[model samples]
Target: MKLAAAAGGTLLVSPNFAFAGEVDNLSIAWTTDTASWDPNQRLSPDPQTILKMVFDQPIDMTSDLKLTPGLLTEWTLADDAMSMHVTLRDDVTFSDGSKLTTEDFRYTFFERVNQGEELDIAVGFGTVSDIEILSPTEAVMQFSKPSPIVAQWLSFSASYVVSKAYAEKVGPEKMKTSPMGTGPYVLTEYQRDSRIVLTRRDDYWGDLPSAKQITIEIIPDPTARLAALESGTVDIATELSIRDVKRLEQGGTLNAVTNPIARIIYVTIRADGVFADRNVRLAAHHAVDKDLLSKAFFGGDAVTINQPTIPGMPSFLPDFHFDYDVAKAQELLAASGFGPDNPVTLDFATTNGQFPGDYDIARAVVTMWEKVGIKANLTVITESQWYELNASGKLPPASLFVWENGTGDPELFAGNMFDADLPFATYRTDEVTAMIKPLLKEPDYDTRIKGYEEFNQYLIEEGAMIPLLQAIQTIGYRNGIEIKPWANGLIRPEAITIS
Candidate 1:
C-alpha cells in the first residue's frame, strides 16, 4: 500500500487554531437558508449547530452505523495504511433506542450515497471492497483500492448513519423532508428564516453538549451579524469580514477564531461543459482575476491554488498561481474565437448552504471579468437547484462555480467530473480518464503519485476549471466555546464545547 501523505506539495499551517480556551453557550447566525431537514440532502448550518442532533457519521465502513464509538476507543490499519479494521463499543445506542446493525450499514451505501447525485461523496466510500461483520460490535473493511486518507475521508457527515426504521416509514424521499438519526440532539422546531431549534437528548449516547437548546438564527447581513454579537442578541455569528476582525477582537463581548480549511475555493471548468474545447477552457481560465477576488471580496482570507486539489494533498501543485491579466486573458480569449463582438458571458450560481458569502463572491467575480471585456452574471440558487443545473448543464451558460477540492477522495473528484459517461459535474478528457482509471483501483504508492501528477499538470495545460485561490472556511464564535479545527475540512458539532 502506497501511503503518500500530502503527495501534492507542502502547505503552510494557519496559526489561528492554536486556541486560547473554550467558551460557554456559544451563539451563531448564518447567511444561508435551510430548506431540508433530511440529512441525505444538503444539510444546513442550523442542523450542524446541534452537533449530535440530526445524524451521526458512520464510524466504520463495513457495518451498519451504530453511534457506539468514535476517534478514541479503537481503529486499526493494515500496517500499510491501505485496509482499516474498526471496533465499536457495545455499550452505545441510538437516540431512537435501537441497536445499530451491519445491515443498516449495507442499506446506507447500497441505497443512498451510491445511487443519488446528492450523496456522491461515496466515491470516498468506494474504497471498502469487502466487509465481514464480525458481530454487532466489530467489523473489518477491505479496500479494493489502497488509499491512506480513507480514514480521514470516512469522517465526512455524508456518511451519516440513518435509522432504517425511520427511512422505511418516511421513504428516502420523504425521509429527506424530516430526518431521524441517532444523534445527540433532536430537532424540535424549524421556523424558516427565523430560527432552527434543537434540544439536547437527555439520554444522548455520546458526550452530551452542555447547552440544553441550540437555537440558530438567520442573519444575512455581515454587519448585522457583527452587531448582534456585540449587542448580545446572538451568541455565535459565522464569517467575520476582514474589516471587522479587529473590532471583534477588541470588543469585550466577542472573540474571533479563524482557521484555514482543508477545502480549496475554486472555479470548476466543465470538461464537456458548454466550453469543452481546450482553448475555450484556457480562455476562461485566463480571463478571471483570482488575486483581486481574493483581496477585494474574500479580503485575503483565501490562499491561491495552482490547481484543483488543495495544497499538501497528493500531487505537486505548481507555482503558476497569480492575478488575472487582461492582455493574456484577451490573447487566450481571442485565440478561442470569443472576441469583444462575440463576447462571452456566463452566469455564476451557487447554493446558499454550501459556502459562506458565496453570493458576494459571485458578484465580485463578475466585476473582475467585466474589466476584461467579458461578462459574468450572478445568481444565487438553492443547493438542490444548483446541483440540478450542474448535472443538467443549465447554470453556467457561462457562470461562476466553485468546487471545494479535497472534501472527498480523489477518484470521486476525477470520476464525477472527468469521466465522460458518469460524471456529475462537467469537463472530460481522455488523459483525465486514463489517469483516473488505474489510480482508482491501483494499490501501488509511487505509481499513484505519478498518476496524480499527470492529472494535476493536465488540469493546468487543459485549463478545465480556472484554479482559484485556496481559502479556509471561517467559523466565528463568541467568548465561551472551545473547539478544535479540522485539518481536512469538517465541523463536527459534538466535538465542540460551550464551556
Candidate 2:
C-alpha cells in the first residue's frame, strides 16, 4: 500500500478489500503499558508503542526507519549549524478542536526545558538558547553552539508537539490523564494497567486509521498472550518468545512476524570495586559466547554484535570482535589474582520478560562466567526498580539492559552509551568521558562518524561492556489481519489493515 495526498493536503492510504467485511475494531495483547500519558517523562521503548497513537511528533519515522514530515512540513539548518528554521502544517488541529500553531511547538521544547521538569528529552535540547516564533506556523531555533543532530532529535522519543494553551490551563499533573493531540486516534477510556481503549477521530487531518477502535490489554506473561491469540480473543499478540512464534506458525492458524529493531542488548559493567581492574573486565568479556547465546535463546534469529550499534548503523565495525576463549578468560582471571580457589564475586542484575530472551541470556552468561572463576550473584528485578537504582547511582557492577536508538544515529547509539556524563552509561572512566564528549557536538558528519568508529575500537580494547545480541521484535496475529513491522518495533494502528 502507498500513501497519497487528498485535495486538502491530507494523507490518505489506498484502500485494500481482500476479505469479506470491513474491520471496525481491533484487540491487541501487549506486553506492557505506558508508565504515563505524558510523552516527555520517560525514554523507554515500551511506552512509545502506545503514546504515538495519541500524539504526533514534529517528524515521523517510517516503517523503514526513514525520516518524514508529520506535524512539521519543512525543516532546514543554517550554514553555521547554529539555527534551525521549521514550518508546521496548517491544517492540523488537536482532538479538542484547537488549531495547532508555532506556540505549541515552542512550548513543547523551550518552556518545558525552562521549567526544570527533569525530562528525558531535555538532553537533546541542551545547546538551544532560544526559540523565535516567526509566524503562526513557523519558528527558528537558535543554538548556543553548533547542534548537528537537531533534525534527527525531532524523531526521537518525547519530541511530540503539545497544545500550549491546553497544557498551561490543565497543568502538568492533570494533563497526564487527559492528553489532547492532533493525531488520528482519541483516548476514550484508560484503566491504568488493565486496559486502554482509543476511538478513531473521524475528522482527523491525516490518513484515517483502518480500525475504528483499538483495545489494548496489558498481558505481562508470554503464555497468557499466546493463549489469547489461540482462543481468537485477541487479534494480535506482541512480544512472544521465539519458540512460541515458531509453534504458532506451524499450526497454520496464526501468522508470525519478526522485525530486527534498532535496539542492542548488552551488559553494562560499572568501573568500580571488583570491576575496576582492567584484567577483570577483559576476563568477563571473553567469557561470553555470543554464538551460543544466539542459537540457544534466539534460535539463531538475532545477530551477534561486538559493539552496541548494529550493522546498518554508521559506526558499526564489521571486523571488531572478541573471540570466546575459555583459556584466555582463565588466564586473564589468573593475572588479576582471581582463580577457582579465590573467585571474584559480584552482583549481576537482569529483568525478566522485558525483551525476548533477556532473562535466559543473562542466566547463560552468568554460567559461563563461573567457569572462568567469576561468581556472579544473579537477581531479577522489575524495570521500574532498575531505573530507580540507576538514577541513584546504585546500579550493580553488571546489569543486562537494552539501548534503544530509534533515530539510528551514531551520536545516540555510541555517543550516549559511552558518554560518562549521560545517565545511560555506568562506566565512569575519565578516558572514556574525554573521548566521547567532543563527538556529541561535532558539526561535520564525516568527522563524527569517523570519531565513533575509533571510539568503538577503544571501547572493545578496554572491555567496556559485554555486547550480546541485537534485539528482534516478535509478534503473532490471526490470519485475516495484516500488520506491517516497523524498525522501531512500534505497532501503529493507522498502518494496520484487515481483509
Candidate 3:
C-alpha cells in the first residue's frame, strides 16, 4: 500500500494501488442508515453519504474540499451573479443505458418550482427561479436575486441529478423506493435500518471503482462498529470514537484514519415556548463548558467552537468569545425566576451513536447544566425522528444537532441557521431575519464577510444557540483495505482501494 499526505499533513492510504483486476467485495459498518433513497427528498447527512454512490452531483469536491467537476464538465457564473451557465457531460449514461442530458438537470432543480411544491432541500434552490435548457448538454440557471454562492451550492447536499424520464415515469412516491441516476454504482438492494448493497456498473462513464460490489451494514453503535472491524465482519468501520481509534491503532491488524470535517455539533435552543426568554437561553449557553466536553469525549481531537462557523471559514470570528461561567448561568437563571430551590426544567433531545461521542457529549453537557440549577430532561431519539420534529417546528426547548457544511460557505452555515424562513432556524426573530437577509445576496466578498461578522456579534449577544465543537471523522479499517479521507467526511466508494 502507498501512503500519501492528507489534510492537516496526516498520512493516509493513497488511492493508487497495484491490482490485477476488479476487487470482489468491500463491506463497511456504517454509523447510520439513509432515511430516503431519493437524493433530493432528504437533506440529512447520512442519506447524502449513501446517495452520492448512485447519483452524480453537478460539481464534486476533492478530498481536500476543493471544487471539481462531477456531472457537469464546465460551469460559469454571470458577472451580475444572477445566473449561471453549466455544461453537462454528453458521454455519461444512467445504469439502465439511457443518456444523461440537461433535461434531467432541469427537472432535478426546477420541477418542484414549477408545481408550486415545497422542497425538502430548499436552501440550495431557494433562489433558483428557472433553468433554461440550451441544448441536450447545456443549460442556464436563472436566480430570483443575486446568488454569489450558487456555484458552491452545486457541490453541496441535495444537488445530485437524477434521470428525468425515469423519475417522471415512476412519479414521486415510487421514486423514493426505486431511483435511477448516472453514477458509478447502482443500488441493487436496500433494507431499511439494516443494510444496503450497491453494485458497480460495468459501463460506467468515469473511472471504475475498486470494488465490484459494496455492502454497507447499518450499525448505529460505536462499540458495535469497532467490534465488526476487529472481528473481520467488515472491511471498514466509520464514525468510531477517538478512544476506539486509538485502541485500534495500538493493535497491529487494524489501522485508523481521522480528519476534521466541516460539520459542527451544537445545541439548538427554540425561540418560543419554554426558551422564549433570552435570559434563559443565555443561561443555557453559559452552562456548557465546550473545552471540557472536547477533552472528555473526543480526547481533544475535536476543536471547540464559539460560533457556528469554524476556523478557515469566511465568517469565522477569531475574537468572539462566549465564556463558561457557572455563576453567570445561575444568576441568569435566577433572573428568570429559577434557582436551586425551583429549578428550570425543560426537555433536551439528542441522538446516541449518530456521530462519534454524540451521546457522551450530550450527557456531559446535561450534567454541566445541572450544576447551574438547570434541570434538563435529556431524551435520546433517532435521526429520522429528529428531522421529523425539526421540520414540524416542534423540537423541545433544547436539542443537540450536527450541522453539515461541506462547502465551508458562510451562506450555508450561519446564513441558513439564522434565516427566519428556513426550517433549520431555531432562533427565529424579526431582528435576526432582517440581519441575515441582506448577507445572503451580497455579491461582494469583503462586504459579505463584514456583514456576517456583525451578525455573529448580534447572535452572541442574544444567545441564539450554543455552539459546541467541530466534528472529526474517524474510520477504522483492516490492513489490506485502503481508503482516502475526505474533508467533508463522506466515504466514497471510488476513493477506496482493495489489495
Q: Kindly give the number of clashing pairs for every candidate.
A: 26, 1, 0
Model 1 TM = 0.78
Model 1 lDDT per residue over 224-325, tens place: 777887777777677667557646666666676555654556666665644666665666667676767777755676776666666655565556454456
Q: Candidate 3 local accuracy as lDDT?
A: 0.82
TM-score of each: 0.78, 0.95, 0.92
- Tens-place lDDT per residue, model 2, 1-499, is 1111123254322122122334678999998888778777778888897888888888777776677777877788776678888888888899989899999988988888777877777878877788999999889988988888888888888778889998889988877788788877888998988799988898887767788888999999998999999999899999999999888779888999877899999999888989999899999999999989988987888899988788877888888777888899899999989977789999999999998888898999999999899999999988888878977988999999998888888888878887766677778889998998888778777788999999988887788888888899998999988877788888887667688
Which has the greatest lDDT?
Answer: 2
Q: What is the C-alpha RMSD of each candidate to the true structure, in Å?
A: 6.4, 3.3, 5.1
- lDDT score at residue 275, model 3, on the 0-100 scale: 83
Worst 10 residues of 3 by lDDT: 1-10
In model 2, the worst 10-residue window by lDDT is 11-20
Model 2 misplacement above 4 A: 1-22
